[model samples]
Target: MSLRVTFLGTGGAVPTTERAPSAIFVNREGDRLLFDCGEGTQREMMRAGTGFGIDHLFVSHLHGDHVLGIPGLVQTLGFNDRTDPLRVHCPPGTGDDLHDLVHAVGHQPGFPVRIEEVGPGDVALSADGYEVRAFETTHRTVSQGYVLEEADRPGRFDRPRAEELGVPVGPAFGRLHSGESVELEDGTVVESDQVVGPPRPGRKLVYTADTRPRERTVEVAEDADLLVHDATFADDMADRAR
Candidate 1:
């Protein structure tokens, strides 16, 4: 499964003509997730052709630049006649604010919008093959980061070795690949380990939107395939940024 990440917006708190606010779209195996719906995020999505069919929206904070697009996105979806429910994950104590914004447009969308409050160390959302974990982040607001980690995948299957072991080229091969032992026609039990390699590490992506460098970010980003952290200021201005 190929994983694709689209930088919808990368500007700072103030959007520029070249860039919108802060929004990132991650599509892993076609399971789309939008991180931080900043100002004009829907327009950015349209421009990028990512569509508004996001599976989940993960907000890092309650800052206007970070979440100002929720109302517009909800209204756009309503105009498009969307019927599927949309789940929005946000930091603790900010769910109510997000709820207010969802309906701040003076009309509710035809779909159901669920606001989930997640704290540090909480599994915010669990999907078929991956999970979104929350981590502490240092920011002006009560913010948190997110880590999207996929489950370990099965190792490569040695088809030649399986066939050499007298295993048939049928369902037994699938069973062996699935880590199950299979008995052959001659009553010979073929172990999965003999034909399967060690388990492979799955892909991991971490997003720390608008946060200072924190230990939790480093911890969650360990061995991650992609780490998207905030760089609102340059290192030369580190002293002033604090």
Candidate 2:
């Protein structure tokens, strides 16, 4: 499985010519997910060639710089003749506000738009082999972070050892690799563990938009492959940032 991340926008509350706002595009095994849709996010996506096939959008907060681009993106998707539904996952109690933002122009897109509210410790989105979980963060408003974690994969297959155990190089190998016991032609049962190593952990990425330094973030970001946090303030403004 291929996992890649593209930072569409990474500007502060006030965007500049050099940067846009807070938007992140994650492609895991061809399943695209947008973290935050700030202003000009659609243009950034087009420039980056990320495409408009993203079906899920996760919002950390309702700040303008964090979610103001939804209306435009939705309209663009409609213009592109998108017929698939779009699911927007956001913080609890902000679903109505986000729904309104999607129709800020007093019109709905041709496709369906569903706004899902997820709280801290709740599972925001569940995919085939992974799940996006929500976590608490220290922000001025009702904000939360997200963690995209894949499921544990099976251990490496021991081909040499399996051959030594009289396991033929055929469908039995696949069965063993999938943690299934196989019975040889001679009625010898070969356990999967004999040819499979321990289970390995999957990839994990955490995103916390516009939040202060907190122990909860540390705990949730432990052992993560990528950590996207808020760092708009400089070290000199640490007191004010807090």
Candidate 3:
């Protein structure tokens, strides 16, 4: 049950000495995910002590501050001799452009770079324990946000029921809580459901790369454990964002 998120950059078009650009790193139980690799993101990652072996990169749009780290990250991964393919995700209608951008660095990387273009409600990435959903955002150009959600876990263990079934209270309780059936010393079998309740709720995290405050952000980020929104400018400059 491990989920960690790091903001590699939080600035806009012009990166300052303080904030970099728009990159977020999520490590969910060893699944390394990078969102929006802005300019100098690789350097920022190094400075922040984040690992370099990222499995996926999600791009919100084609803005220079949001996607300028592609070539360098790909080259660095190659230099480090990474063999696994790198999955790059983007908004709809930019698959070909992303493909060209990765290859524009001159030579084919030692590892494969799989670029995928997605739209709202699409499942950008799914694994055994977690899923990432893409959602739309209102930006000058087309953009999409991401929501990281984990699978529901087994409910609390019913200790009384286990004891009533003659199941011991030590290791057997752990196995039962983990959804495994256990047999007591007396050979009485205890089913997992008899010792555990329904699945419990899981955690959710949302990342809205850069967009004017919109309804889509509200809908997708409801009850999220953490929501990283764009605070690019003040209220007076709100018109410029549109």
Best candidate, TM-score: 1
Candidate lDDT scores, in order, read 0.91, 0.94, 0.88
List, residue by residue over 110-185, the lDDT tens digit for candidate 1.
8999999999999999988899999989999899889999999899999999888988889988898999999988
Runs off by more than 4 Å, candidate 2: 163-166
Structural similarity to truth (TM-score) of each candidate: 0.93, 0.93, 0.89
Question: Candidate 3's residue-wise lDDT over 1-242, tens digit each?
Answer: 78988889999998999999889999888899999999899998998888898999999999999988888888888899999999999999988878777877576888889998888899999987889999989888999899998889789887887888888779888988988888777777889999799998889999998888888799899989999998888898868755
What ordering of candidates by TM-score runs from best to worst?
1, 2, 3
Taking the tens digit of each residue's C-alpha lDDT, what string does model 2 give over 119-209? 9999988998899999988788999999999999999999999999999899999999999999999999999999999999999999999
Could you tell which candidate, 1 or 3, scores higher by lDDT? 1
Q: What clash pairs does model 2 have?
A: none
Pick the winner on lDDT between candidates 1 and 2.
2
Off by over 4 Å in 1: none
Give model 1's TM-score versus the native structure.
0.93
